[model samples]
Target: MTTPSERAARGREARKRVPRSSHGRWIPSAQRPDPLVVLEREAQDRLPELVPLRYGRMAVSAFAFLRGSAAVMAADLAAQRHTGLTVQLCGDAHLLNFGVYASPERTLLFDVNDFDETLPGPFEWDVKRLAASVAVAAFQNGSTKAKAHRAALVATESYRTTMRSLAKLGELDVWYQRIAADDLLPLVRGDERARVADRIARARRRTSLQAFNKLTETDASGARRIVEDPPLLERIPDIDRVTLGKIFSDYRSSLPEERRLLLDRYRYVDAARKVVGVGSVGTRCFVLLLEGRDDGDPLMLQIKEAGRSVLEPYLPATAYDHQGRRVVCGQRLTQAASDIFLGWMTGPEQRHFYWRQLRDMKGSAEVETMSPDTLRTYARLCGRALARAHARSGDRIAIAGYLGTSDVFDRAVADFSLAYAGQNADDYAALGAAIAAGMVTAAPGA
Candidate 1:
């Protein structure tokens, strides 16, 4: 049998054959133009196009707009790659993307929960997105630049150090150990330690049963149901609903025999239209209520519309043809444990989407409500988690070799973050201009 180290070496060697390039060149930082300048132009082009989609709904707050603005920034960041190696990335890995969800083992694990835009790209693209998010989040919370810089620096340092450490570990070890709520206290500082402990205690109270109770209700006929309201939420149109019903019936054929058996035990109860997340609001989404042998026993599944990955056209070349499949596969590769029911299905309309439990003991730390010290601690935690996720898919040794022991990369990220935050301000101004010019309908408050 192969030793674990030998197995890791083989895995690493396999990765070496995978193409790693950015726009066909290895441009270093000094040679690259300011990423912020590129971001501004992309935002000017894309953000105006999205405004008409907002309609009469309350203009999503500035913070919410920033989340959607990632596509613009992603385009710019991809154009300015300083490093040659890139890995599948969580395109908008902000502080909020780090959250608590149950692993397959039923343990509450903290990790990156969204993967809609995940794809292979320059590693620093992720780091830059994360850093700018920290700045935006801190600014929204009234944090001073100095304090925010301190937090950003801490986050970048944690990422650099954690990636280096993972580089030395056996591949399986790196893959198996994920950060848990139980690990927070040791890394927290001062009064924030007690606050983090309190938060974890609160998070622990939210179990699957608690989630079921909060989201499900029984109708007058005593059938378990998910209620819906129109515009914000509604039943999916009958034509599409019928088509999806047929597609889901065929979905069983794609699953393994054992998985098909498990799914066979439940029947689809109802499907309701739902809107979700800051960036995903306009996309088609639905919640499927599944009934087992008993009427009261329910399982809720969310089927979201998946589009082409924002990174696909930019990627050099790869074996995976479907961008949605690439996302699901990448998520499985990076997450220590994922939802057991996680799977993908395609519709007659040719759209692709991945499905999973709607809410299985899912919760997030309220960063806006957190104290500064706690925010700093949480930043470090998110940084470490991001590093671990990257290590699972990238060349850890080469990354570690590039990062070294010094704080150069950390400091560089901090600098980029400060500069990028300024760029976000400029983009936000341009968005305001588009709204003022009647080029697009602005949401109520926006």
Candidate 2:
């Protein structure tokens, strides 16, 4: 392994090869693919009936469009020059992707919660995606262009400062660092701290029992089962008890020995196909309700089908053959504390799938209704979290040296984010046009 001093020297040299100001540039490729065409390609493998729903969600707003267009951005980012400083990336690191969830120890921890498009890629790609999301979200919330740009700047600066701080820490120290609820409240004051506290309180109530009570009930046969709601949550056709038993057995075997033993105590009750999130709307996702010792004791798990990451084409090939294992391994690598039940398996037809708690106190910032002050604070927190995640897998000293003790890179990223935010609006408009032309079928705001 290279010494920290040597890494710093290499990072400084990297600055000369790709100056910070160059990061601000966003020249679209002359042959850039149509956004609608890219969306069509992405939907080809998805469920035909649910593809329209994905378009419906993305049609909501430019910010929504940006959220669902990870593949489009990945293609664009691939066209840009990079510093070659790579990390295990959350390919879709939008503001909404950072959330508070329970760690293995049941402690409240805030970190990146989505890993659908995760892969090893240039560190700035993640930072730039995050900054741009802040700008786009602010604009969607009726903030001025200046305020939107400021949010991006705040996010970039926070990431830079956090990376620099991490560079000075020992490897193990940096690896062990985490942003729990207790560690975060002290960083803010008054309303900001109160907001964090409220979010924490709400997250505490969002558990398996809460979900079970709200989504399942005792049927006429005296057996508890999940309720079905058409178009969103419905039972798969022809799937019976024998098939479910096998599925659960395979999933249980995928877990760690201890976790498998723990899961063995529970009996599967019901499963419903559930649609979730903007980007994941068309993917095959299911909610499984399990009963432990009694009807009051319940556990809910999500079994979501995993496809190739958006970054797969641009980044080096992943070592894992199963996409479910790719998502699980990537989540474990980036998060300091991951879900204890997190595991993956391959289903029929070679489809990869991963399982985890359906909702374990998962709470995200309500970006749509955030005040400018709250947005800025949230952006900073996201930056800090992203920096720590990158530092765990990438060379922190090198990245910090490249950024230096200045705001040049920060301002550059802000500028890039603002530019990309505009492009997102244009892309959203194009999607609307496609729907109008009958080229894409959607329910608009569904």
Candidate 3:
């Protein structure tokens, strides 16, 4: 058996052997399939599997499902991976998924906030998804195609530059340093700088206590309660509810003794169903309200449905044996700071993801509403964050070498974005056709 050092060396050599694409090569549009058709097929497959977890008021529209269809898009795109060793990807590293959240240390940090589809795969798969998202967002905001193209180019170039820089840094330096919200203010245009500052300040005020307040309330009996509504939110099934209640106890037992002791101080006050996010619709998600000492002292925890990563089945060799564990492990690996309560459990009812302090000072720039300069600033920041994430899991030197100090990769991504955005539009159209043909029932306002 090879020693660990030898194994690492072999991995590095394999990465070095991967070929790089030449600049100015023409990749025809016809070579790509319609994105909507791909999306519809995925939606159809997932819809049946989602039956057990469809909470009331959840987003069931074709559009809602399409938002969560990154897995489908990823599989299609991975089939076209041309060059570069596939690194573990954020799978859904779109602009919107990049946002601000409090670290375990209570410092507000900006980084990728979602990783349901994360897996080891081609690096350009991420670049292409991000670029396509930029184009779609710009188009939605009524920006001209040229503006969208420019924004994509700037973002890709930032990724290239940052990856190269990180490749030269020591591991400790790369891991300890991150681009914070404050670091982005100066990069914005003069007119938008004030708004960005104000946003950051507002974000700073968000805390765990504040999140508890927003998501919880007291009933007539003065017991803590989680607010709920139909289709959007409802009580979990009795079987699932009972199973989850027992699992929470097991989860507490699984924590470090100190944390378990801290958790014992709180009483389970109430549980209610909640629907969250455009892409995460139809997944079993619940909010548990816990009370400590008095009714006034509250804690909120979310148990989200964790499923197999979309990238797993496609890239079978690199896929984790357990999808839920992959999510927990991937989140910890990629985020600079993660939730202390972050953990996973598999029960007979379903696999559940446990996390704490939802909506704590969480804020994202409205990329759709951004002016050109603000968009540039946001793009660069996300690019840097993406590079930082990739560096953590792969050999940065080889990636940097593949990128070099040139516009070749930038221009290639920009060209790919233009081509792929058209693909997404076509996919969106196919979803519309499926809805029109009565093939699938779409949720309202999806």
Candidate 4:
């Protein structure tokens, strides 16, 4: 194996190919595709009736637009050169995607929770997406441009510093690194600590039992079932329910022998087609309710369709034949710890699907409600989580060397984030205009 110095030298050499400072530039090319067209094309295979809801949700705000337009940003990032440091990317690394979730060990951990568009590619791409999100979120929350830029800077600086620290560790030490939820409280200042603790408390309460109480109720016959909330949550048809029931077995087969036995103890109860996430509005997603031990015990699993990663068009082809497996594998590789129920299967018409707990202590920040200081603190924490994630799959020493002992990369990414936030705002307006002109459809407030 090469020494740490050799790896560091290699990373420094990459600067010659794509200077870290060059990341600040964000001149939209005249050839850039229309944002609406890009979104529509990317979502062509989705359920047609629900497409309008996606557009409506995305129209909520400029930050909402950014959240839903991962493909749009992917295309833009592809237009520019990138550092060749490869890592399993959380293709949509916006601030909200990094949150608290329960690991298999029942330990709460802070890490990247979403992986809908995961794939291996250049490391800086994820950093740019994160920085851009921090800036957009800060601006939407009413922060000044300078404050927004500083918030974005905090994210990248935290990432750089975290990566540098991880680089000094041994192999197993780096592999075992994780940011525990309990450890987060001490990091926050006076008033923020209580708020952070409350969020964690809320997440712990957001279990299958909480979902069982909120989502299900007794019918006249005394059978409990999921309540329909129109366009957002609807009970699946009996036939569709049967199809998912069969697919559940296939998903179970993907798990380890022990997990399969653990799964067999629960009997399938009920299911619903549920809408989730800003960008994932129109995807084929369903929730399966299962009962174990007694009627009081419940487990909620989500089976979501998996399509090609948005980055696939620009980066290398994924090695997995099944897209669902790609998502499962990527999630397993990047997360410090993964959900116990994680698995993948092929559904009808050969569509790909991955299953995981619908709500295993999952909690995300309410970015719009955060004060500027709180946002800055949260942004830095997310940055640290992301760096730990990347170090698991990439060359930490090289990444640390590329970042160096200065804040140059952080400042450059912050500048890019601010510049791209302007591009995102213009695109958001264009989307609204399309809806008004009858070129696009939207079901506002859905």
Candidate 5:
């Protein structure tokens, strides 16, 4: 086998053939798939009734449109020339997808929060997606084009710098490194720091018990169950009690033996179809409530349906037979410390599903209301967190060598983000036109 030093040397050499500046080019092909058509096809197998809600959410703004159109971006990225260095990609690594959540130790950790579309692909793909999201989000928040470009630049530069630093560390050291909220607060100043601290406070209160209290209530007979509220939260009809029991039992079997034993203490009480996230709105996601010891003690687990990743068509198929297992494994590999109850199983009719805490001190950046300076700080934090994730499965030394210690790759990626932001705007307009022409329906104010 080649030595580690030799591998990094080869990676540095590869960058010479495909100069970093070459990545700046973005000329769309006439053969590029229509964003609306691609989106419609993606929604084909999803719950038909909730499909309109998905479009409605995407129709809200250009940034919202970009958030839900991961497959469209994946197809476009596949058309671009990429370095063959693959990593565990947060395939939809948009700005809003990065967030703060509690690690197993109950510490506030910042990392990529979504892995529904995760897969192994070119490392640059995640960087590109994240950078473009910063541009798009900045513009949506009424920042100047220059500010948007700056955000992308900050993101790229931070990723490059952090990855290079991590590359110098031993493998075990890199694995143990984590970005906590306290570590991030110092990067901001005054109001931004105050804002992050407040957000952290809010997230700490967003635990399973909070959700249980807010979403469930007791009946006259003294039994507790989740309360339904229209299209967003409703009970699944026609599911027999035995089938429900089997589903919960099968999901428990997917957990670790110790977790299974711990789970046995809780009795399953209720499950509801709970719509969540802009991209995941139409999927079959359930909020399962389990009672532990007494009515006051509760656990809420989200069993989200897992489909083939958005990158599946562009990349090779996953080795895992079940898509849920694919998602669970990818989450474990990419996250610093995933939920203890994280597991996966194939449910009735072979629909794959992954299970995790429904809510556990989880909080996302409020990008919409962020000032330009705050946005810049957030962009860099996300980039650093993303670099850590990539380093987990990717060859960090080789990647760091390929990136080099300069702003060439940063400038190139920022330029590409600006260009792709234009494409995203065009796609957003087309969706709006489709909605206006009666080809699609969107909820008012959505």
Candidate 6:
């Protein structure tokens, strides 16, 4: 293993290769592919009927467009030079992606919750994505351009400061780092504390029993079954039951021996097809309902289709051949603690899927309606959470050294965020234009 001095030197060397100030640049290249074409390609593997819904969601606003178009940004980031320092990226680290969730230990923690696009790549790519999303959100929420830039800067600055702090810690301590729920409110204001507390309470109430009550009902025969909300949540037909058994068996086998025993305690009650996420609408997603010792005990697990990462084409080939395993591995490495049921399996059509609890106190902030102060504070929270995650998978010493004790990197990223926010607006309008021109059909409000 290299000494800390070498790692620090390595980080500084990367600066000479790619100047920190160069990060602020964002002029779309002449050869840049059309954003619509990129979205079209992404939709190819998705459910055809839901394609329009994805487009509709992306057309909602510039920030929504930024959330759904990770591939477009991946391609754009690929075109730019970056610090060679790399880490497991939260492939789509938008404002909404950071949230509060329950750890296996039953402690509430704030962390990066989405991992559909997770992959190893240059560290700055995730930072840029996070910063750009903040800028887009600020604009959408009616913040002035200057206020937006300040919010974006706060995010990058928090990231830089957090990474630097982590670099001074011991290896095990850094690995064990997590931003607990208690750390959140102090970052926000006094009156807003109630709103923040209310969100947490709501998240705590989002349990399997709550989902059971809301999503299922007893039939004439007294058997409980999932209610069908056609297109969004549909019952698995009789013909697919046998295939479902095979899928369950495979998923169970993928778990650890102890987890396999834990799996054995629960009997599968029902399963249903479900649509989820703005960008992942068309993917094959399913909610599995299981019963424990009695009628009072319930567990909900979500199995979402995992495809090749959007970052895959831009970065070097990922080591894992299975996309589901790639996502699971990235999450395991980057998260402070992972869900007990997290596993991957191959289904009937050979599509890869990863499993996790449907709801374990999972909740996100209301970004669209946030005041400028709340948004900036929230931006800093996301930035710090993201840095904690990056430090887990990358060399904090090198990353911190490259970042140095200056705001140069932070300010440069903030500038890039504003410029890219403009580009995102243009792309958002382009999608709206395409829908108007009948180039693509959009389902009304999905």
Question: For this target, which candidate reaches the highest TM-score against the unseen true structure?
Answer: 6
lDDT of 3 by residue, 1-446 (tens): 65434534543454344423432133444555555455444444333444323211123332233355686566666566344555668989888789887776777788887887878776767776777677666665667889878888888888889988987788798888666777777687676888888888888776546756776667898765666666555655444557657777757754667877777888776776676776576666777677788867777777776766666666755445555567767877887777676666665655556455555667887775787656766887888888888888866766776776768778777766766666656556665566577664555542
Candidate 6 C-alpha RMSD relative to the actual structure: 1.0
- Off-target runs (Cα >4 Å) in candidate 6 are 239-242
Off by over 4 Å in 3: 1-66, 82-86, 237-245, 253-258, 317-319
Clashing pairs for model 5 are none
lDDT of 4 by residue, 1-446 (tens): 99999999999999999988999999999999988889989778998999999999999999999999999999999999988998999999999899999988888999999999999998899999999999999999999999999999999999999999999999999999998999989878888889889999999998989998889988998887888998788988665567767787789889999999999999887888999988998899999888999879999899899998999999878899899999999999999999989999998778999999989999988898888899898899989999999999999999998989988899999999999999999999999999999999998997
lDDT of 6 at 406: 90
TM-score per candidate? 0.83, 0.97, 0.85, 0.97, 0.98, 0.98
lDDT score of residue 213 within candidate 2: 87
Which clashing pairs does model 4 show? none
Residues 108-227, candidate 6, lDDT per residue (tens digit)?
A: 899999999999999999999999999999999999999999999999999999999999999899999998886787877787988999898899899889999999998899988999
lDDT of 1 by residue, 20-103 (tens): 221122223454444334333333433343324443231344455567666666666766634655666887787777888787
Candidate 5 regions off by >4 Å?
237-241
lDDT of each: 0.68, 0.90, 0.67, 0.92, 0.90, 0.92
Candidate 3 accuracy as lDDT: 0.67
As a whole number from 0 to 100, the lDDT of residue 57 in candidate 4 is 94
